[model samples]
Every structure is written in C-alpha cells, then in structure tokens.
Target chain A: MSTAKDTAGEDMPWDEVTPEAARKLLVAAVEAFAEQGYHATTTRDIAGRAGMSPAALYIHYKTKEELLHRISRIGHEKALEVLSGAAGIEGTPSERLAEAVSSFVRWHAGRHNTARVVQYELDALSDEHRTEIVELRRRSDAVVREILREGVESGEFDVPDVPGTTLAVLSLCIDVARWFNTQGRRTPDEVGALYADLVLRMVTAQK
Target chain B: MSTAKDTAGEDMPWDEVTPEAARKLLVAAVEAFAEQGYHATTTRDIAGRAGMSPAALYIHYKTKEELLHRISRIGHEKALEVLSGAAGIEGTPSERLAEAVSSFVRWHAGRHNTARVVQYELDALSDEHRTEIVELRRRSDAVVREILREGVESGEFDVPDVPGTTLAVLSLCIDVARWFNTQGRRTPDEVGALYADLVLRMVTAQK
Candidate 1:
C-alpha cells in the first residue's frame, strides 16, 4: 500500500534507472524482506538499509510493491539467465541437466536471501504482480521440465511422471536456501556438485 | 505467550488428552499460524477456529509457543513413527528408501499447514522454543542421513557427501508443502509415488 512515488528525486532517469542504484536497493530490500516478512517490511527499512532517503527510493520506484516486483523479476531473470546459458550446450541429457542443476544450486546458495524473498514472499505482491512472478516461475520450471522430457524422449531418462519429476528436481535446488549457510560443512560448490549428481541420477535411465 | 494447563477432568492421564481434541486444536493452530504468521496468531484465534473458548484451549496446552512446539514435535514424531515402523524390514536399499520417501512426502502432503508453519514460522518462536524445535528437526534430518549413510556404507548408494545428500533428499520432501494442494494435478498419493521413485533413483547404487 506504500507507494514509492510519494517519496522520487530529480536525479531519476526518465525511461530507466541506473543499474548500480537498482542493485544496491535490491540487495537492501532482499535483506530487509528476508529478515522481516514482506508485509511487515516498510519502504523506509529498505531505504535505510541502502543508506538512501525514502525520497531517493521513491525516485527510483513508484511503490514498495513495485520494488518487490522488481526484486522478484530480477530473481527470475537471473535464474533464466543461468538456464538459458545452459540450454544450448553440447552434451548428453544427463550432462546438460547436471550443469543446469549445478548452476541453479550455486545461484541459490550464493543469493539465498534474494531467492527466499522471491519464492516465499510473492504471495504478498499485488495480484497482477503475483501473476507476473508466477508466470516467470512457470517458465523457469518449464526449462527443467523440458530438459527432463528431452531426456525421457531421447532414452536417457525413464521418469514415469514428467511434471512430478520436474518438481522433484527443482525442489531439490530451491530448498538449498532453507538450510544452506556459510557455517555448513559443505561449500556452495560442494553442495551444488553433489546436487547436480543426485538430480542427474534421479532422471538418468537406470542401468 | 499463551499457555495451556492440563485439566483433563481431574483423573485423566496426561497422555489421555484425546487425540481428537488435541488434533483439532493443532489443526486450528496450524491454520492460524499459516494465515497470520506465528507472531500474529493469538491463542484466541486458534481457539476460535477450533470452536472452543480460550480457557478450554489453555486447559490442554501451556503457551502459544508450546502449541507450535507441540505441532512441530508431533509432526517430526509422526515422520519418525513411519520410519521406525519401516526400519529393518527386508527390502533392497532402493525399495526401503522409496518407502521412507513416500511416507515423508505423504505425511507432509496430509499435514501441509503444519509443515508450512513449522518450516517457515520458526523465526517467531522464542529462542528456547526455537532451539527445541531445531533439535527436533535435526533429529529428523539424522534419520534420513543415517539411511543414506548406511546405503553408502553397504554399497547400496555412492554419495560423496552424506550431509549434503541427506539435505537434498529432505529438501525434496519439504518443498512439497509449498506447492502441493488438493487441486494440484496429481493426488498426494500419486505425487508421493513419483517422488519416492525419483528419490530412490537418485541415491540407488549404479549397477
């Protein structure tokens, strides 16, 4: 309900904002939202965390929900960036799928707060924003599903239920945020590699 | 800080506090916590949902945190109940693991609200209660890790990292609550079976 336009500065670009300011604000927003529930977090908290005035934040975004929308959108786009980069690689189904899974796990482990806010806090978004985020999430899921389907059709995997299998794979990656931390015995790379192996085996054709 | 006093008609044993009543209150607590969050849900909200007066609710439990504690404890205990029952039964590693995974997924699906509240709302608990719940969660994680470790030791599986692999397996099960619904494409049973198979394949030893 807190609109951002109530607080924009004269320095804001007409058509787009600067990447550095947006990134700084997004990082601060992610931390605040992760620490406080989306509904409980105020635009002031994000602005304070970013060391900027509320007016400066408003200058960059029109609404608090708009900031959340941007955060969710960026998270989804980053995931797509990882998956899209892996899509064209030349490899067997298992290899390509493992790479995709590895990328996802690493991305999640490194940017856990962002991932958590995006995945768990979307329910707090406006209906339109929620729909947009959900669609982005669907596309992300589809990337994994398409890989699994390709593996099945190519005789590299033998999953009986394509959609469920897709869910299983993504769930394994998305849940890293719930438990992964620097204090854990395994590094992000270690966990990512192990998950990649686990997922590959899950879908690969049984010997 | 709502507390429930044991006042089961003077002569009843503590353990005899009727599962129906306890379950009713537990379900109500789960719903209230899920909808309004742990910090926001009051004993009265749960009591209202369970069609009971606050005094009657207090007769069964001590503290709102205790209610959360009980819900989490019971949920983990239920998981251990299934695991302990299935333990030592004669089967291949994949078969046994599949049964375990199925039980976990099915339990979470059936207790989705409890699962969500326990997993997502721990931040609202006091430190002592939170520590207690964390221990319970760790014990549950230990059960799955033991299974994976035994599989690896017996050459039934070949995981390089036991802890991460165990976390990955549990992650797959835990994330089900976030997405599973009665209106979902697959019934809980179907999802359970698919996930069980997928998990089994993930950890089964290569031929």
Candidate 2:
C-alpha cells in the first residue's frame, strides 16, 4: 500500500533506470505485476498506467517480459547493494549481520510493491533473464553467508549450518514484502529492528 | 515439483473435502492456481486437469473463486490442525514451540503446491470469502501466540514481544512454500529440522 513516492525520496532505487519514459513504464509494470501478478498483467496495462499508448510502450521495451526483466535487474542490483554495503562496513560480524538484515528488511518493507514483483515473479521471466537475476541473488546470498562465516570463525556467533542459516535470514527478510502494509501497525523501521534483533538472537552464542 | 500423490497419502489434507469428484477438481484447481496463479487460471483449465467437462466444474462449484475458497478453507484448517496439535502436545514450552515450527514448516514444504495456492491467492478471493479466510488465519495466529505467551510466562523463553515474535515465526514458516523446491538439496524433513533449530535459538534464554 506504500505510494511509489514513499520509496522514491533520497536513495531511490530506480533513479538510474532510463530513459524517463522507460523508467515510468518500469515503475508502472512493478505496480501492476505486484497487484495482479506477472501472468495476469499485460504490456498495455503497463503502458496505460504510465500514461502512454501501447505503441509507445514498445518504443522503450519491446515486450512485457522485457519490462519485467529490467525491473528485476534493477531491483536485484539495489538489493545486492544494500547487503554488500552492510557486509563491507567496518564492524564485527554480528554488527554487520544486524545492519545487513535491518537495512535489507527495510528496503523490502518500504518498497513492498517492487520487492514483491522482484521476489515472487521470477518464474515469469525467460530462462536467460532468470539466470541473470539468479546470479545477482547469489551474490546477495554470498554477502550474508560471508557475514555468518566470519561470525563463526571469530567465535562471535554459534551458527551450526552457515549456509542454511544464511538462506533462512534472506528468506525471512524477503518475505516481509508479502505481509507488510503501509497501513499496518508496524512501520518499516520497527519491523526491521525487530527482525534484526531476532536474527541476532538466532546467531548469538550462549554464554 | 512434488507430485499430487506425494502429499495425498494417509494424512492427506483434502481427504475430508468430499465427494471424490469435488476433491479431484479441488486438487486440479490447486495445481492450476499454483502454476499459473489465480487470476490467470480458468475453471476450464481446472476441469480439463481433473478429466472433467466444464459443466462438471459448474456442478461442483459455481465459480473459480468458489474452488479457491474451498481450497483456502480446507488448507487453513489443515494448517491450524498442525499448529494446534503441536501446541496441545505434552511438553515444555520450548519443546512445543520447536514441534510447532517443525511440523508447520514441514507441511508448507512437503505440500508446497497446495500451500502456494492457499497462502498466495487470498487476495483474489471475494471480499466476504477473504474475510472468512482471514478469520481462519487469525485463529492460526492465536494458536501460535498462545504458545509464545506460555513460553514467556513460564520463563523458559526470552521473547520481548510475544505477538511480534509470533508473527515472525508464522511468517518464516509460511514462506517455505514460496522458495521450497522438491529438487532442492534439502528435503522437507531437513528444512523443518533446520528451521526448528533456528527458531529455538531465537527464543531460548541465553545461558
């Protein structure tokens, strides 16, 4: 239920996707795909939502799939950026992991629409497109895995299965998009903090 | 990727949704909705998949939404049964919570196809139908919340926000349907065990 603008202010994700019309189409596509799902949406619906004709839609993206691909590519890149930024920060692995989860969860909750389409609509993409997106996702996973691995190495955390735990962390954050609502009781920040605390508990070593 | 038969054994969730023909249509509808989503799947497709005529579908259910509602209702009841069974077991709060998460997660992963349709297609239901389904979900939430409340009251758990943690635990388990693949490295049992361990860590008091 977040207005597109709610997620568009400073550090906006889609600012780099061009031209302006193409970005509009991409934004509209995200909205449509999130609301009705990828299989039920059409290129004409994206074009209409963007205040353009169907023909004009083709001028920027030839097919609805292309639009989805672009949106997915950009969205994944943003997600990777959020995780990589936290992973690279100068802090203990626990601190880094908390930051990574909190920020990643915030993005999913704040941009629930775009995150929903990016996280749930992978099957709608062509094989080639899906492969590219999956690669981006792998990098995101690696960032979290590295944090968990470092924590275990440093004896700062007690994760028994780093890979499985990494998947759970990412899966936990990604699903915030499915249930988050702008009108919900918890704000994005609140949920982010709560999840971060819970995640930290999952990894913290018992004294 | 699981076959319908894989989840239709002795403890099949839909056995109670008779008659035989109606159950077939419901199973077929779950497949169609899981594969193509609710908006994109037609009743004709459900009928064909069930080896029945369109008229047969009409005789059993007036509309596609009716099929979805029945599936949702039955699926939710099964989910509630899983959680409530775990909650009612004679064990410590920690043991019960672990049992609840493991079994609930197992159901979501082992029956991913039906779980996908039941969890994700709620938005497509009619308002009245959605409200009914939502009420069922509230009961599911209540079951989990009661367990967490007991854990907190018994001083066996370190939960700061019982209601919020309940949502996180339920959200984590429900999402297994979205990412769980039959061909994936982890089996339903393994994933359930891993998740149960992780969730236990999330609530156990630090020594």
Best of the candidates, DockQ: 2
lDDT computed for candidate 1: 0.74
Specify the poorest-scoring 10-residue window by lDDT in model 1 chain B: B5-14
Clash-forming residue pairs, model 1: A4-A62, A4-A63, A8-A59, B2-B63, B3-B62, B3-B63, B4-B61, B4-B62
Point out where model 2 deviates above 4 Å: A1-13, B1-13
lDDT of each: 0.74, 0.87
Which residue pairs come into collision in candidate 2?
none
True contacts kept of each: 0.63, 0.70
A1-207 per-residue lDDT for model 2 (tens digits): 123373333123477777888878887888788778888888888889989999999999888889889889989998899889977899999889989999999989888888888888898899999999999999999999998988999999999999999999999999998888887899889998999999999998887
- Per-residue accuracy of model 2 over B1-207 as CA lDDT, tens digit each: 123373333133477777889988888898788777888888999999999999998988999999999989889988999889987899999889889999999999878888888888889999999999899999989988888888888888989988889899999999998889877899888999999999989998876
Please provide TM-scores, in order, for all candidate models, with all chains considered together: 0.82, 0.95
Best model number under TM-score? 2
